[model samples]
Target: MLRRSPHHRWTLVSRVMVGVLSLLALGGIVVAFAAFAYGRSAARQAFDPLLVGAAQDIAESISIGDEGPVIDLPVSAFGLLSLAPEDRIFYAIHGPDGALLTGYDGIPAALDTVQPRFRDWTLQDDAARFVTVSRLFSERAYAGRIYVTVGQTTRARRAMALDLTRRALFVTTFGGIALIVSALIIIRSAMRPLEVLTRDLAQRDPYDLTPMQADGPQEVRVLVGALNRFMGRLDRQVGAMKNLISDTAHQLRTPVAAIRAQAELALEDDAPRRLPRLERLVWRTRSLGRLLDQMLSRALVIHRIDNAAPTAIDLRDIALTVLDSRDHELLAPGKDVQLRIGEDAVVVLADEISLTEAVRNMLVNALRHGATPVVIGVSPTPTGSAIWVQDSGDGPPDAVRATLGQRFERSAASKGNSAGLGLSIVRAVAQAFGGEMTMATVQGGFRVSLTLPHHGAGQSQ
Candidate 1:
């Protein structure tokens, strides 16, 4: 035997149909109750007046006879009751002394008041309605009251009520069906947008990550906009991955070949000549290692820029953290490196790791290419926050400055000694955080600054 699934999934149309049908059923039940009540009230009102009129006619026909009272039943009274031919009727007359004068004797005489009254009763083992009226008499022979009672079986009233209910139910059933059909059409029309979106997504090329047109009802438009944003993020991540692979292959090949050749030469050289070849081999290996490390760092920085949530960071803290790492001392031993930051906090909204990597690259570039007495500092600019690395020498010549941030673009002064990715990393971080990198000749030295938009203290992005 096949097992049933634990979870049941319903389509939008199915849910809407179920909802519409449920509402209609509930409404039908309420309408049925109301129609039944209205029918009963109307039936009673229609027949009660006839019973009263017949009782009054019988009471008026009574007169004082020679002995006491005589009842002369009116033919018109019977004619009025004949309107409901399917019903059984009964009547009775009584003298002032409580004697049955004429007609059926079982209907009791009224003892409450001298007024006409109506009630429900059973006669001849069948349900019935009754009306009693008292007639006053003043004559020479008899001077008292005569009572008239009239009743009828309720068969016709019940039939009339049932007929009315049936007619109302007939109208309601057809009307409810029509309303359900119209609701289905409206629901299907409303769901068309989702159908179109599903088809568009299904037919799209896997590589196509462009934003979709967001045109529909407000809810559908919101869904489309969210889908577009998700695709955009995915596209950026894929592009970053592609760039990492290509940069790794293109930048590492020449150095890797050079390292292999130097290694082979060192192994073949005589002991007298082996020390210099070994030194060159070690230097080439270190340069290749540094190049690989910087390439990976650039890739990671790009990834984090898109994926990392930003927090409010004080620029002074970043500068202090870089100084505390002691990496600069290793990069350039015996070089003058100092920090110039005030006590006040200068904050920006950025990824901490990515920002630190950018700042570290700035210091590395200053140590490798610029003169001694290097300084790193943080300060508040009029428009934003600034973290800069300045050295005692004039910055790269104007011709080299234009191509400075491009990957692997070396200057003539470096003479093939630098990897050329430091400024590129700084530029990427600056642009990613809605900021800019500037190279300027300050009063003391050449300065490379990464200026970021100011974030309010304690605020996060």
Candidate 2:
């Protein structure tokens, strides 16, 4: 069974909107609670003064009479308490001995000597607010202090507080919703640039690698730049592939045609002369095979140069491996491929496969064009490491040597047998490693060197 990939993706807008709305909802709840508390406190402030006023009026109305003290509660005291029409009012007056002189006896008097105080209590089994006040009176008949207590049911005050709290909650809730909606709209507007960028990319041709216009917010610009860089790399890869295909087709055409023509000639020849023609055909076929192999090798080297990661490579080890290979023994029988090196390990940073291919090609070139006693040497230079192939024969002329590394360009000496890609492959490998290929005539022979950057001792093994 084919397993499906997980589908868990979230959009930036949705995440932002969810986060913003959550914060707004939390803020709205906090604001609603604050409004309720402020409203309740304001309701208490508005009603406390009325209760105090009524208590003071009652205290002032008390007078001295023939019985020692008398109480004549004023109508204004009840009028003041009637401000909250839906509430029941209660009052009490106490003499010096703590005995209720007049009014409701159930209402409690002040305990301490406090002049005025407010409290919440249960009266007639209903929640009520009350204020207590003490007043001093001096008269010829009687001189003492009287206490007044006034209270009322909290129904009307609670109603007012609830109305205020409800209004505040409604306003806060509406404003919070508006803020959320506005935030969403702003988020969408801000994302338009990204949308346009996506649409532009979707509408373009598949092969197009043109850079996009990086105009937007800094974040969007960075994204566009990254996309453009990726496209640029893809374009280079595609171009390399195209060039390789084109070169392969063009170079192989002549040799393949030549092989077919030679085969036809061998077929037409009579029995006695057919052997020589068949031999020529075989040689032509082998040359064509060699050409194809070299072309493919060059292509592989180019591909690796573009894609492969570099590692620590010892040039002496690579030279020994290449010399010991079957192909090397076939090319130069009798152990003619010699190795010469310094004492210390000659190490460089390179891709081993490509570097080996390059060295193999150089050795093949020296064997094909120069005399026997071919030598492969590795040594450490001041800046890097060098791997060279030398042979005992006159090298190409100065003019031809200058153009030796160019693709499909061969010296007059090796034109018929060479595909002219060997030196080019070596050059490419050297350049890939930030190195260079050098040719010089030494004694009576020629030497070609591939020098690469040395890996320092501090680098990881």
Candidate 3:
């Protein structure tokens, strides 16, 4: 069963858009608050000075007459207040004895301060702002200070503040929209390269395992490079599979035909001649079985090398494993097969199973093709760690040595029984693990070794 992803997947574009919109919404709220405060302050600065000027003009119009203090209620002062034509005006004068001398009778009294003062109050049942001023007279009837209070309704002041706020909100709304549009455009443009890459991969042939073009931004190029490397490994695995199928079909045909032919001849022959023919038929069947087993083993080694991760392994362990299996005693019963390894470890990084198979094949090849007293050992050399099988005889000739590791290239001694796949399996394992298979004429024998790079400590070949 296929597993579903736990998270709700979102496209890259959707994620970027959501992030941009969230930021802009928060910024818009803060900007709206700032604009409202600025509007209120601007209205106050523009109109407060005018209110003070009108109050001062009204103070200059006060005088002492025969009836005590009086006020002319200057037209110039009224004209100055007319700047807000939609607002109502109120004014009042007080005698030195605090009696209402002229103008509106119900105006709120000013505070007892000498400096001009402004205050808020209710006038004619509506909210209003007022300014108060004082003057002193030395006339006979009125020799004390006089006060003049002027006020106006707040309808026009509120309208002005609201107007300024509205204009600011208009500009901010359009600017936020423009920013959102630009962010979307930029995000789509950035994602174009990935879209193109997806399209190319979707349309390519199924069998095509070619490397992709690494283009666009640095991040996109990195993704393409990783994909290319993965495809390269897959291609090698496919090639190996194809080779196995082709080799199986080509190698099995002649041996099967010969075996069938021998069996038919045995069935027709007399009892006296039948024994030899039956023996030959049995020999052919055994040779075919060995060939099939080696072919399958080689295929398995290739598969594991691609899929298995490598680890540090002691070469001595591989040598011991082969010696302990004692399959050699079956092939060459009573033949001398010596295990020669030192106490020190000879370690290399490799797949343990693949290395063991390769070493086992080396021992088998040596036992089959060389003289008696075959010796298997793990030793440290100047170049690398070596697992070797040696026999007390001269190695193959120079011409045969050149072609030794190729599959099905049998030497003359085996005649026709040998499958000639052992050395090829050793070569495959060696090359797969970044190692090499070497054959040399040693002092007392022929030697075949699979030498691999040292993992932790250096060992020479």
The model with the greatest TM-score is 1
lDDT of 1 at 58: 88
Error of 3 at 425 (Å): 2.5
Give a tens-digit lDDT track for model 1, residues 164-190. Answer: 888898999999989988999999999
Count of steric clashes across candidates, in order: 0, 0, 8
Ordered from best to worst TM-score, the candidate numbers read: 1, 3, 2
Judging by lDDT against the true structure, name the best candidate: 1
| lDDT agreement of model 1 with the native | 0.88
Model 2 gets an lDDT of: 0.85
* Model 3 error, position 370 (Å): 1.8
If scored against the real structure, what TM-score would every candidate get?
0.80, 0.68, 0.71
- Write the residue-wise lDDT of candidate 3 on 1-461 in tens digits: 97767445878898888889888888878877777788767866776677778877888977767875566777898786798999998888776677887778888757364787788888778989888888877866658777788888888788887787788778887998998899899889999999999999999999999999999999999999999988977887897788788888899999999999999999999999999999999999989998988888888888888889999999888888989999998988888999999988788989989888888888888888889899998888777888999999898898899899898889988777678888898999899888899999989999999998888763433
Off by over 4 Å in 3: 1-11, 29-185, 381-383, 456-461
lDDT for every model? Answer: 0.88, 0.85, 0.85
Model 3 residue pairs with clashes = 381-460, 381-461, 382-460, 382-461, 383-460, 383-461, 384-460, 384-461
Query: Model 2 Cα RMSD, Å?
Result: 6.0
